[model samples]
Target: MLTVMRHELNMQDRSFSTYLFGFFLLETIGIAAMIYNINNKMANFEYCLSTITLVFVLIIPLITMKSIAEERKLRTDQLLYSLPLSMWDIVLGKFFATLVNFMFPMVFIAVYPLLFKRYGNVYLLTSYGSIIAFIFLGAALIAIGMFVSSLTENQGIAAGISAVIIALNYYSLDLANITSSTKQGSLLVILFFILIIGFIVRSLTKSTLAGVILAALLAAITGIVYLIKSDLFEGLVPSVMSKISFFQRFYAFVNGNFDVTAIVYYVSMTAFFLFLCVQSLEKRRYN
Candidate 1:
């Protein structure tokens, strides 16, 4: 695992993606700093953190796009399978390596609070809390990005897919608002989401029977429940979307609440996606 981490870091040093990510980070932080300190004349660093978090949708794909996709593209994944290391080790090694690369700029961003403290009236608790939440959010997204990368051999496709997923997540709140709150509407949307999940299951397992069975079972259950108590489906889609959105949870931190539930949610998301990444690699080995 350490060897993989070291190799990934070394490769990143020679790659343009690392520098591109750095540039994005610099630009995001720079603009946030200008707005908070100059234009807004506010000492709240949490505002800056909130503003820059959206930029992750654009830049995080660059770091994770090549993590596993490049290995498959270059046909090195077979060598990895032959190694004694488990799939989890390889996945985590790559994940931590990408995390380290992402954290390079964050180390500097962490100092912003202290720097602002020197000026006046920086809400240190909320500021630092938001920073921590921001890091966790990025880590969670990176795990999802890594899983997306593992699904394809082409880096560009991985990045594009990841960007779309992250962008949708960033806007999940607005998307949820646009969704209908009616029981029938929510039921239809839930059925659609189940179909999407079925497709994902099929892709991951490469088993049409398994995917079809799972989807049919879930759809049947949803239909039964909806028929029994239509009220239960009322506003279900929007509520679920609001609950699961990563950005929505981060707003709690920005609002000066050190929400433990949000932290747990982010950690759970990170672990779940990393597990998916391991499974994706294992599937490759079997194939």
Candidate 2:
């Protein structure tokens, strides 16, 4: 695992892609912070952080697009598959490598609160909490991005999918508002989601029957439950969609509440997606 991490870190140093991503990421965040904190005289660094978080939609793909896609493109993944390491080791090494690279700029950003404290009163607790949440959120997004990268050999395709997924997650709360609230509507939406999941499964496994069976079983269970109790699905689609909104959870810290639940949610998201990445990579061995 450490070997993979070192290799990835070394790869970043060897190529211009990693530095390009880091440059853009830091520049955007720095400009935002400068405009808000210095020019605008805003005391709340968290707001500046919030404004800059949107840049992740652009930068995260850069960080993760080449993690696995390049490995596959270079045919290095074959070497990884034949190595003695377990899937978990490889996945975690790659994830943490990306994570460490991601954390580099954040280290400088962390000093913003102290800088603000020098000028005037800064809400240290809330500011630092939001910063922590922001890091976790970025880590989780990187995990998701890595998994998206693992799905394809084309960096552009991985970047596009990562952008779409991250953007949707960022705006999921707003999107949920447009969804139907009725039980049958929720059921149908869930069925559609299952179909999408089936598509992903089929793409990954190349097993149409397995994907169909899994989707059908899940749809049948959801349909039966909706039929048995129509009331249970009231606004369920919106509610579930809301849960997927990454920025929504971070808002708690921005609002001066150190939300433990939100922190847990981010951690869970990171772990879940990391697991998916491991599975995706592991499947290559069998495929």
Report the number of the highest-lDDT candidate: 1
TM-score of 1: 0.95
Q: What lDDT does candidate 1 reach at residue 134?
A: 89
Q: By TM-score, who's the top model here? A: 1
Cα error of candidate 2 at position 180, Å: 1.5
lDDT string, candidate 1, 218-257, tens digits: 9999999988999998898899988889998998999999
Instruction: Give stretches of model 1 more than 4 Å off.
Output: 199-211
TM-score against native, each model: 0.95, 0.93
For each candidate, what is the lDDT?
0.90, 0.88
Candidate 2: where is the Cα deviation over 4 Å? 197-212
Cα lDDT tens digits for candidate 2, 158-227: 9999999999998889899998988878878888999999998888779999899999999889888888
Backbone N/Cα/C clashes per model: 0, 0
